[model samples]
Target chain A: MLREDVTEAIRAAVFEELAAVGFARMSIEGIARRAGVGKTAVYRRWKSKLSLVLDLLTAFAVEGLPAPATGSLYGDVRALLEVAAHALRHPVASQVIPDLLVEAARHPEITEAVRATLLDSQRGVVAQVVRDAVERGELARGADADRALDLVVGPLYWRLVVVRDARLPEGYLDDLAHASVAALRA
Target chain B: MLREDVTEAIRAAVFEELAAVGFARMSIEGIARRAGVGKTAVYRRWKSKLSLVLDLLTAFAVEGLPAPATGSLYGDVRALLEVAAHALRHPVASQVIPDLLVEAARHPEITEAVRATLLDSQRGVVAQVVRDAVERGELARGADADRALDLVVGPLYWRLVVVRDARLPEGYLDDLAHASVAALRA
Candidate 1:
């Protein structure tokens, strides 16, 4: 296999290992075997298991976060929700996230990576969306943007990921978008 | 030690083991060792590690959930949020919950226990509060009680547990309660 193909295969194997047996039990040798690569190949790419996992998580975090400019704050909020919902619903992400969160609590280095790469990037995207909304006068001045951002994205995470309720009802997103707007205004 | 004392010791040890190594690595022998009890003593109280964990989780779930009748819907909502916030903020709970949630996704038996003992009971409490609000004319007729419940409790979980943001701003509960009511109205 080419270098890029080998890299992709390793990534896929890592996710599978994460799903099958969470982060605590996942091993570098096991990941190598699953990827059909030698231990040397895995070690060449990543100095340690932590580095590999962090790089994968960082890559996932930075992918496809578009700051939606949908004319109205309401539309922008809905657009953002759509992106979040899709990501949370991804099969690997749905499983990996909860496990990683627990891992983050235990490992400070992982926690730092999550905060810097994932959480900071997400916060930046939402902040930009809120900033645009405020400039357009759709949102009132001095609204707590941070808290409003939490309200906007919190429900989907709660219902879909935390509660493990995968089957979202039809129009749930629309209703959630509307509620998020209402919460922001409130 | 008396039988009750042994059981209590075993329970405490299980929590410590869960915190130290997480659920995937937690074992009955480890728990017994930590509790200063024999393995047979641990087994006598509970058939298996899963059963012991589930029982402890069920006990925690049923401990202190009261649907506060605070006359006003707003007050009731805040009360419920307070209860949820307190539980989520508990030291052991803050750690164990995320671990158990991941475990639940992999294990059907844990999933069922969580649904029946924890999620359903919490939902029932929130539903009762929403029902009272609607009957008192504080909430509109035909409001989506289920979605409203999600809104009411989602932010606290997102902020405290998921994001691990333990320091909520002053009057955060009031703001959340107000936003929830707005979401319900919307």
Candidate 2:
């Protein structure tokens, strides 16, 4: 395989392995077999199963939810939620996220990796959005960005991922966006 | 072992095993070994790993979050977040809830089991709490209970479980409870 193809193939295999067997049972051999590459190829690129999974996860996260400067806090928050909702709706993500979340609890190294990559990266985007709101004077200064982040992002995650496939009312994201804005302003 | 002792032992084992290895790697034999009983002992009590986990999860769910009738919507919502914050802080739960959530995505039977037990039971309580709020005129009538449920509980789960040891400023739950009520009212 070309170098770029090998890289893409390995990334695809890791996501599938996570979906099929979850993090605890997911193995380098399984990933290699699924990718149709030798285990050596897998290791030649990434040093271990943890590093490989984390590398792919970091790359996926670095795809980065767009930070919209829609001029209003409500507009920015809604756009971000729409992007997040679409991403969480992916087939592999719904399986892989909670699985890795479980792994993070068990391994300190995994915990730090996820915190630095997924958690920090997402929080940074939201904080910037919140900063935009503050600058607009739509939100009071000194609003807790962390709590605001939790409020905006959490419900969609709960409804979509943790509550997996629960029937949603029409315009669920719209309602959530409104609710999140109210929460932030309050 | 005495009959009740056996049952109790099995229950404890399931929680620990879930915390240690997660749902994917957890097995009946491992549970039995950890519980210091034969596989027959586990089998006699529950038909499979799925049932055992579900049964225990139901019992844990049935322990039920307090739906505080604190006379107003704000008071009640805050009370629930406090209870939920306390519950999610349990080390086993921080691990096990996400594990089962992942399992639910892959297996319809497990999905149904969790939905009926965890999702339904919790939503039922939150629905009743919202009903009280509407009647009290704290929140407007015609609020969406499903969205309300997500607003109240999601942030706590996100902060404590998924964020997993993110540092909090003082009175984090207080800020969260306040934000949740604002969102629900909006």
Candidate 3:
């Protein structure tokens, strides 16, 4: 309980700092200020902003790529996308992840870590869904699972980061889920 | 030829400025300074940075939306994604469009123009492709054209902005193209 609480407190500080100044401008000092923690304590846990923010992102959004066994491909994908959209809609997750990703383009270590974490986490969700669909005969036998996953989840990322507008409407999610099912089934 | 050359030069300079400093940090004065032109000269042609940058982005990449008449859905989509990839690979086009879109989120005028010029232009392209597909019975008569187009181009935008990677492999393009076809035909 002590470890869990401490981890959450640090993460809360990281999220607050990110929301206030963004990931690029956020610092351990600022996080400490916001969290009311000593700088040494914050550094003792994360060592750097990237490391702290990365863990926060992992804990907040990328923690589990849950694959719901909804008994149908469309339902399962819909569940995944809806949950993803909800999780990403958080002020901290949305602000920090995109900024960190933009920053990652310039910083190789950050880029590698972000890429590895996202791809690994996403791939796991996609593989399970695809495998389930294949076994259920809902997906084509030879359909490429990873590519299908990318197609399924890629649009949500685009709408959030590139479009940077209103949240994904229910219609948008439904369309994505339907199209994903169609693609894999084809 | 003279008019085209001048326009190209102006667009190139605007694009370069965008890449150097993001949309918020970039200004007409900065663009003028970078382009070696008077601010009055820029204002005389385009009303604002939003217009100038949007015009350049549309000119550079919007054409990719108009899919070729490739008889088969596969060929048509393959050609479409290829053109989209080409747009991203173009330095000025790739760097500037994302900056403008992100800027549009906070600016009303830019958002309006993005919807009218950039988004509308590509939507038309996708619509035409879907029409052709429907005519050929490649899609169901009741297939939702707008949703289909979103799915088709969504992955490309996702990889570019969300991934924020410097380079995306041709394999990604291939995978998206194939997956879109599979989805459509399913």
Candidate 4:
């Protein structure tokens, strides 16, 4: 396989392993075997299992997030929620994300890396959206952007992942967007 | 030890085990050893490892949740958030709850038990609170209780557990309650 194809294969294998067995039990050999690559090939690119996982998680975080700039704050917030819902609904993500959260809580290094790569970046995107709304006078100048961002993203997450609700109601995203806008305005 | 004391010791040991090693690795032998009881004694009260964990979890769920019925919907919602915040902040709960979520994702029985004992029960409480609001004319007759409950509880759970934020802003719950009320009204 070409270098890029090999890299993609390895990344896919890592996610599969993580989703199936979780971070605690995942091993380099298993990832390599699943990817059809030599163990040395795995070691050649990443120094440790933690580094390998971190690299994959960082890449996923970047690829998964797309900052929306739809004119209205509600539009932008809804767009972001759509992206998040799509990612969270993925089978691999549904399993791996929760497991990673447990791992992150146990390991300070993973927690800090997750905060920087995933949470901070996501927070930054929401902050920019809030800033745009403030500039457009769609939101108050001193509105709590941080709290607004949490409200915008939190409900869908709680339903999809925490409650493990099988199906979201029709127009759920629209309701969430409207409610989030109401919260921010308040 | 007295029967009650023995039971309490085993319960404490289970939480400690769950917090330290997580559900996948926790064992009856380890729990017995930690509690200073025989393995047979541990098995006498619980049929299986899963049952033991479930019993502990159910007990925790029942003890942790206390539905509030304050006169106003806002007051009741704020009261619920405070109760949730207290549970999420507990050292054992902060660790065990996240780990259990991962385990629940992997185990059907755990998932169902959690749904019945915890999520459904909490949702019921929120539903009753919303019902009371509608009766009191504090909310519209046809407000979406489920969505309102998610809006009310999601942000606090996301911040304290998922993001693991060290400190919530002062008056955070109040803001959440007010925003949730606005969302329902809108």
Candidate 5:
């Protein structure tokens, strides 16, 4: 395999391993075997599984989160929710996220990396969206814009990840978006 | 040892094992060893680790949830958030909830038990609170009560469980409760 192909193979295998056995049981040898490469190839790119998973998850999250410039608070929140809903519904994500969350609780390294990269980046995006709304006078200057992000993102996480009952009503995002904006305005 | 003492020891050991190793690595033998009891004592009470965890989790959840009856939407929602916040902050619950959620994704049996016992019961409590508010004319009869429960509970779960960064401000719950009530009113 070419150098890029080898890297890609390792990346794909990392997620496959995570989906198959979870983070605690996952090993470098297992990832290498699934990738059809030597363990040296995996080690050369990343020093450890924590770093490997960290890098890939950061990349996946950044790639998946496309900030919406929908020009309205409701539009932006709804669009973000739609994108989030789609990503959470993916088979790999459905399995891998909760597993990683469980692992992150025990490992402070993973916790900091996830916080700095994934959580902070998403918060930044939400801040930007809220700023735009405030500037447009759609939201008040003293409103809880940061708190609104939690309100918008929280329900999606609650239903998809924790509850898993999937009682997502039709047009759920639409209703959620409407409520979120109304709440922020108040 | 007396039968009650053995049962209590086993119950305590389950949380300890979960805190130490997590659900994926937890075992009946390990729990028995931790509890200082024979395997038979553990097996006699529960058929499998899943059933054992399920029964304990159901009891824990039921005991933790008190169903606030403050007779007002804001009062009830805030009370619920307070109880939930206190429960989520417990060390054992902080460790065990995500582990079970992760395992639940893989095991349909766990999913059903968690949903039936934990999620449904909480939702039921929220429904009762909303029904009281609607009857008292604090909320409209046709308002979205179910969605309000998601808004109320979601942020608490998101911050305490998923984010775990502890950005929870001094008056976070107060602000959230106010916003939740406002959103439902809107």
Candidate 6:
């Protein structure tokens, strides 16, 4: 539908603007201008800036980052985090995504959508990899895949988001992947 | 000094308001009104609302809960997470501290203060306990104390901040603590 395309265009523009200006300073007028649409057109698509930004974030935050199937569970796990860390360093992922995540805590609907779109999807990938590992007798039957996934992803996020480091250092992902796999073995 | 007293009052008032309204809606004027001081008092002390909030957050967030000195490594780990988890569940801790954490990500000064006050403090506790465990041969000397600590704390914070789950169920702390220790040992 033309309307759907217009909505996508406006959301794409909003995501770009959010990357540039952040959540607090992102303006509806600016998004409309960038999308080549009127203010009313933008307003008709989203009820509020929060909803608009939420939709944009949902689309852009988690899409296109699929976990690798590297045959070896360890390789697959490391590849997953390596790709995710690199993606998070992308301009949009780096700059505005954190702002949206922090703000989402305050807005319940946005928080839920981001969780479904961003966290769980990534988590689901990790779970499948772990399931494969379990089937292959690499990981124990009782091993909590989600917890194992957290072991790999959590520290990077802790360092990046909580500790606010510039980037993960060389071999950090590999170290985490190896250690986490060893930790979860039968 | 009279200036110091006023600063303290403004900081305390800001803390109360943050617990009450959160960072998005919190205002210098509201802090002043709550503190029974003029807006100028807050302005004279801090450059921006972020600065003011960060200062207050740094001061108030360094809560040192008790850690049991149980001889067993598992018991000590269990006790530590239990204490941290319960502290997080405390009404004030849940409502007030997360906003500071979110704000800390946006501001460098705040992030450093948080590292010093909250993260480092927790790390110290974990390190001390892990050292005990290593000395007792409960954990292998090669165990990465820091990563093990992160394993325990990360899931709790992820649930609290990301999932926004108010109730941390019974035995959750024990499960995480045991799993973290086991993960490291494995």
Name the regions of candidate 3 deviating beyond 4 angstroms: A1-21, A24-52, A58-62, A92-95, A137-143, A159-172, B1-11, B24-67, B92-95, B116-118, B160-175
For candidate 1, lDDT tens digit of each residue in A74-174? 89889988888887888555787778878887787887766665466678778888888889997887677668768988898888877777889999999
Two-chain DockQ for each candidate model: 0.77, 0.78, 0.35, 0.70, 0.68, 0.31
In terms of docking quality, model 6 is: acceptable
Please name the candidate that would achieve the greatest DockQ relative to the true structure.
Answer: 2
Candidate 5 chain A least-lDDT 10 residues: A58-67
DockQ of 1: 0.77
TM-score, second chain, candidate 4: 0.89
Query: How good is model 1 by TM-score?
Result: 0.95
> What tens-digit string does per-residue lDDT give for candidate 2 at B1-186?
899999999999998998888888889999999999999999998998988887887787666555789897877887887777777788545777778878776777777766765577678778889889888888888877788889988887888888875465688778778888989887
- Estimated TM-score for each candidate: 0.95, 0.94, 0.75, 0.92, 0.92, 0.80
Select the stronger candidate by lDDT from 3 and 5: 5
Q: Where does candidate 2 stray beyond 4 Å?
A: none
The lDDT of model 6 is: 0.69
TM-score of the B chain in model 6?
Answer: 0.80
Model 5 score (lDDT): 0.80
Winner by TM-score: 1
> What's the lDDT for all of these models?
0.83, 0.81, 0.68, 0.80, 0.80, 0.69
- Model 3 has a DockQ score of 0.35
Look at candidate 4 and give me any clashing residue pairs: none
Residue-level lDDT tens digits of model 3 in A76-179: 88888887677557664355555555455456576666665566676677788888888898877766765665677776765664455555565777877777
Arranged by DockQ with the best first, the candidates are 2, 1, 4, 5, 3, 6
Could you list the CA RMSD of all candidates, in the order they appear?
A: 1.7, 1.9, 4.7, 2.1, 2.1, 3.9
Q: Write the per-residue lDDT of candidate 1 for residues B16-55, one digit (tens) a residue.
A: 9988889998988899999999999988789989999899
The TM-score that candidate 3 achieves is: 0.75
